[model samples]
Target: MSPDGLCAHRFRHTAITRLLRARVPLRSVQRYAGHSDPQTTLSYAQAFDADEAIADVEKLDY
Candidate 1:
């Protein structure tokens, strides 16, 4: 039994996040996630993009 509620929800979120981070195809991920809206899957991709952007900014000569 899950100590906290929505453990399966958390698992799905983590799985989707990891899949996105692994650069899986968006359409494929959407199918795996069963998301009707691609935007929902894209939202996870934005986080990965933002993280890479942050790393790039850190390398600035400033």
Candidate 2:
């Protein structure tokens, strides 16, 4: 992909991720992102949730 395409993709990704992280409802973010499938929006939410979950788990004491 071209550099411009990559930048645009990152912008989309970041926007969706930030919205999900902000506790915006999934359906609202999906509509704002123009995602045809709810799963597409869920994927971004899952990725962010998984990353935070891993980080929190790592801080656990034995």
* Per-residue C-alpha lDDT of model 2 across residues 1-62, encoded as one tens digit per residue: 67556757778888998987887766678789998766667677665666654554354343
Q: Count the backbone clashes (under 3 Å) in each candidate.
A: 0, 0
> Lowest-lDDT window of 10 residues in candidate 2?
53-62
Pairs with backbone N, CA or C atoms under 3 Å apart (clashes), candidate 2 = none
What TM-scores do the predictions have?
A: 0.62, 0.62
C-alpha RMSD for every candidate? 8.8, 8.9
After the best TM-score superposition of candidate 2, give how far the Cα of residue 10 lies from its true spot, in angstroms. Answer: 0.3
Worst 10 residues of 1 by lDDT: 53-62
Give the winner by lDDT: 2
Residue 62 lDDT in candidate 2: 36
